[model samples]
Target: MKKTAFIFPGQGSQYIGMGKDFYDTYACSKEMIDLAGKVSGIDMYHLLFEENQELDITKYTQIAMLADELAVLKAVEEKGFSSTVNAGLSLGEYAALVASGVMTPEDAFKIVVKRGAYMQEAVPTGGAMTAVMGLDNETIEKICQETEGIVSVANYNCPGQTVITGEEGAVSAAADALKAAGAKRCVPLKVSGPFHSDMLKEAGLKLEKELEQVEIHDIQTPYITNVTADYVTNKNEIRGLLKDQISSSVRWQQTIERMIDDGVEVFIEIGPKKSLCGFMKKINKEVSAYHVDKIEDLDVLVKELSGQE
Candidate 1:
């Protein structure tokens, strides 16, 4: 079998009825959802499947997205699929950890419950995120540095796409500067907080305490870390990396490149959105990228991975 990497997306990917197909089609999917609710003390089914106001909220969105991703993951594994490596963007990291055997389902659920709540609670008002298109990371970094306040690049998503985050005024100022410096367009994102910015450092500290409670197991399958954009072979680094991830720029582009260098020929994003797959195309078009959001997508992915006769 060719080398495969299982990637999961983070927040902003969740929507109503995301994993309903998997929930209905696979018993393991339902069991994972049930376990998520039991562990998190939230109604996972209603939060995800039903039309509700809580799904978008960060605290709830984290667990909801993780549940959906894991539901689909369960079904994929049952289909006799496994990965050589794993990675996830931001909140999706927990799902990756579970898939890599670094964390059990129960432990991951427990951490996410706290992770989501901490992020939600730490979302300071007057903070914002903006997507800077057609601008190089260095230019964006320079503009953010020149601009006042705590503004910085939040996500290095692709070659020309990077997200900036900071105090509302600072982010706006930086966005304007970026556009003036030849950026295609600086679009203000509908985000609740300055995620991946220094403003959330407190949340990271809180998560560090929470991490101390969970057991970081040996890597059955090595997974990459968002903080450093490299494979995490040392189990000891898990806690610090996960804690710092909340306030660090997500080096998504670098992470994907690292995987490709390490022989990840196929990347299967198992989650609600094809966001990561979209990024993969921008990062490198030669390799194959697939997303198993629905049962039908899984069929296509299975065929692609198993190869054609």
Candidate 2:
């Protein structure tokens, strides 16, 4: 029996026409998309299937990304293949929560609508994020801590790639420091805001209010949280971690490492792109990684998983 992990990707992975294949193939996919539209009060079909600049905006990006991922996830489950554990990055966490049965997709959909809006509203002006490659987490953290402003590590993406976020000035200063500390390159990211940084604390607080309105059920499958990079078995920890996730570093590398350690032999990424699969390669090369973004990808996945059985 091979233990598998169903991983989901976050914001940057979304694109127009992302889940059209699944939507056309599975009734459950269409139902979930419609449900997301109803809960978020946004026309998910147009938002996802048509060309629009709104898909890139934070307020709309969050829910749209999750809806696509969930559509694919439901389709995968329909094939009778499941995961031993699950996890997702940032916005993708909501999809993982739905997969884990901690909350209904309807509840997550509604909350994600607010979550996106609140995060967009809280995006501080003049904030910036940069990817510092070829630097260890300890050195990056040291530079951020020693720097003069709100700068800090945002994502520990993989072994050598770390993202730092904060005030534009502080981030720039940290980039200089990281470069001087033998970093390979410090490239600025063109994100709408400095996500997963302390600057978003107010946004996290606002999201906490929205989270209170949702009902959290018992966990059916365990999942690792980006906030702690560890498995969360107890459903009680879900709410607080979600709130904190807005203002905390995304420990993605650690989360994947933990899953690999816990016997996740295969990682099936159910989403629009192979972003998580790319990360998996940098994190660990031994585990088999697959992604389902198109109808053709589903065929390969079914054959592989069914053969495993």
Candidate 3:
């Protein structure tokens, strides 16, 4: 097969009724969705399909997004599709673990439910995140360092866009500094917490203890870690890496660059939306990128990759 990588999206990309089409079309998708609910005890189907306000809540959104990604992945795998490697943005990393065969679907669902809750509990008030667009990374870093507060870079999303998170006042001050430094725009993100900042170290510590209770299998396929932007080789490091990833900056731009440097020509975004694909365009437009959400999309992907392979 051509060197290909399967990419998944994180939160803020989810919407209600995301994977219903897959659930209704594929037996495996239905089983996978039900399995998430059975393991997590979250009534996932009702939350994803029926009217529920919990879909936007942090605790529920994480699990719901994972289930939808896994459901779509199940159908894609059923079609005999596979990737040389896999990666996910943030919460989507759980689905990448399942797809890479380092974690079982059952354990993923169980761990994710707890992960979501832990993160929710750790969400401190008066925290904020802002997207600094059309600015270079060095300038953003300099401004963040100059700012006096808990502010720091949260996510290195793409070439021209970076997200900073910290105390609300600090973030606001940093936004002003970034704009003064010639940034095109500094847009505030509507998120519950200052994710990917040191503020969530408590959540990571809580998850570490919880992770010890679960089982990690031998890796069948390698995937990139957002914290380090490198491929995970040993199963033992998973616990610590995941623990630190909670509070560390998400090196998404570096992760994509590493994959491209390693000759991963095709990237497939499997999830609720085309967010990852959007990022891919900014990273390397010459590399082919595809998204698979519906059954029709899978069909298109198969036809598209057939000749490439």
Candidate 4:
């Protein structure tokens, strides 16, 4: 039997007017948008459909991205397509929970609102992140350990791409060391803070308290967690994993590999950009990857995945 996976992208994939097509074309999408507004208390239409700096900010980015992703996913599911497995990167995990039936979309929206605010408010001074290209994770990890200050790997994105985060000085020093160690490029990320680093542990603790207020139900489909890069079998582990995910390295590379190893042949990236699709090509060439950010993209997906269903 063939299996399909719904992979969602995180923060950097956001853009203005992301789910406009879906919102206009599908009642499900419109309901999602309205529900997000009711739960998040943000002007959903203005925040996502119009240009604004806050859309890129952490506090607003998480919910906006989630709303957009959920709208897209709902539109896809309405077309009679579904997935065997699911996974998301960083902030995208909340959407995964919603897709898997582990949490209601309304509850997820509420949690994300607080999650985003907590992360934004917890940004440490002088914190930074940098992408290390063309370097192995082992080498980058070793260098980050050797570098002074609170530097550490933030994301294991792909085979040759890893993101390191920490205090600005530490990240800069680590980038220099990584470059000298033969990294092809050490690009500084335009981010608000050292997300996924130990510096954000306080934020994780705060998120844990928020998680306690929500109810988690049994999952309908297995989803890979970024923190463990493994399948979440028991719903009991979801909350802790989400909490730890705040200050933990997003094991995206490992998560995708685990899904592929488990026989996921079709990966549909349901977000604004082809970020996860791009990563899929780098991670593995054998599996088919598609993106459904716009309504027109669904035409191609229908043609390609018609046989799979």
Candidate 5:
């Protein structure tokens, strides 16, 4: 039997007009965006369609990314396609929750709004994140330790690609050290703050309080967690894990490995970009992967899911 996993993309996947085609074609997509706008007090369509690339701040980026991913998911659902397992990276995790029926779309929108605001305010001092390639995790960890002043590994993206985040100076020094240690590249990411690090602890704390007011239910489908790199089904544990995910390193590599170990053979990335598909390929080339970010892609995916391709 073939098993499939649905994964969602995080912040960096957002583009100027992501999901616009779906938004224009599907009434549900427009209604979802409208509801999100009402709850978030953000003109989501404008932010996603009109904002300048440089103006897409982290605060706005989170909401837009969530909305776009959800829009794509809705389209997929309307076509009667489903998956056996699901997971997401960073902000994409919230989308996963929505997909799994663990969180309502409205609640997901509200939480992401608060999450983005808190994350922005939490690191008011402004920080930086960098992706180091061609380096093993141990080498990256050593470089993080060698650099002074609060630098730490934020995301273990893959075997040879890890992202470090922290105070700007510390991150810069760490990047230089990683290069000296023979890293292929240490490129600074265009993000507003140091995410998934201790720097976001304050944001995590604030989010915990907000989380209490939101409703959480058991996942309808098996879902992987970034904090634990394992499957979580209990509602309480899932809620707690989501809170901790704010400031914890995203164990993406571990999560993917665990999914594969559990028998996921086909991974479909449902979102605005193919970022997760790319990552999944790197994680396991034997497992087939596909992405549905355009109308034609969705049509093709529907066919593939129906065994018509």
Candidate 6:
């Protein structure tokens, strides 16, 4: 038997006009997007397609990504394919929860809208994130420790790659130190806030209050959490972990490792980009991975999975 895991992408994978093709082709996709707009009170189609590029605020970006991922998942579900396990990075985790029936799509949209808003408001403007390549986790941690100000490792993305986030000056200093310590590159990311750091504690607390209002249930399929890098089956535990995730590093590498150890021989990334697929290849070359993003990719995926291609 082929064991498969369904993984979703995080914030950075989002692009303009994602899922429009699906929306045009599938009624379910359109319905999902409509629900997203109704719950979040933002024009999903406009924000995703017609809005100016400069309007890609964190809140809108978060909602758009969630809608796209959910749209793709609905299309895949209609194909009668399911997974042994599901996992997502950061905001993507909400999509994972929805797919696993832990929460309704409407509820997930509302939570993510507030989650993104809180995260943006937590940090002042000009807060940034940077990716430090060609450095191990230990070296990155050392640099963050050595830096004077408020920089911290935010995402343990993969081996030889970690992202640091905080105040601009502190992040710059950390980048310099990482380079001095033999880093290949430290590239700043275009983002609105210092996500996944202690700087987000205020946002996390606010999100916790909102989370308490939402009802969470046990997942139909085991969902790996980004905070603990482990599978969470308990409803209450899921709520707590999601709150913690707002201010903790995204343990993506560990999550992928645990999924492989749990017998996930094939990984399917269902979202706007092949970001998770690339990460999976870096973590374990032996594991087969595929991405279904565009309508063509979806058709190809359907054929491949059905053994007709």
Steric clashes per prediction: 0, 0, 0, 0, 0, 0
Clash pairs for candidate 1? none
Model 3 lDDT tens row, 67-97: 9999999999998889999999989899999
Per-model TM values vs. the true structure:
0.98, 0.98, 0.98, 0.98, 0.95, 0.97
Candidate 1 scores a C-alpha RMSD against the true structure in Å of: 1.1
Cα distance off (Å), candidate 6, residue 193: 1.3
- What would you estimate as the lDDT of candidate 1? 0.92
User: lDDT of candidate 2 vs native?
Assistant: 0.91
lDDT of 1 by residue, 84-200 (tens): 999999998999999999998988999999988898899999999999999889889998999989999999998989999999999999988888999999999998899999999
Candidate 6 wrongly placed segments (more than 4 Å): none
lDDT by residue for model 2 (233-283), tens: 777778899999999999999999998988889999999889888888999
List the candidate 4 regions with Cα displacement exceeding 4 Å.
Answer: 307-309
lDDT of each: 0.92, 0.91, 0.92, 0.92, 0.86, 0.88
lDDT of 5 by residue, 167-229 (tens): 999999999999989999999998888998888998988898999999898779989889998
Cα RMSDs, all models? 1.1, 1.3, 1.4, 1.3, 1.5, 1.3
* Superposition TM-score, candidate 3 onto the true structure: 0.98
Give the Å error, residue 151, model 1: 0.3
Candidate 5, pairs of clashing residues: none
- Please give the lDDT score at residue 100 for candidate 5: 89
Off by more than 4 A, model 2 = none
Q: What TM-score number comes out for model 4?
A: 0.98
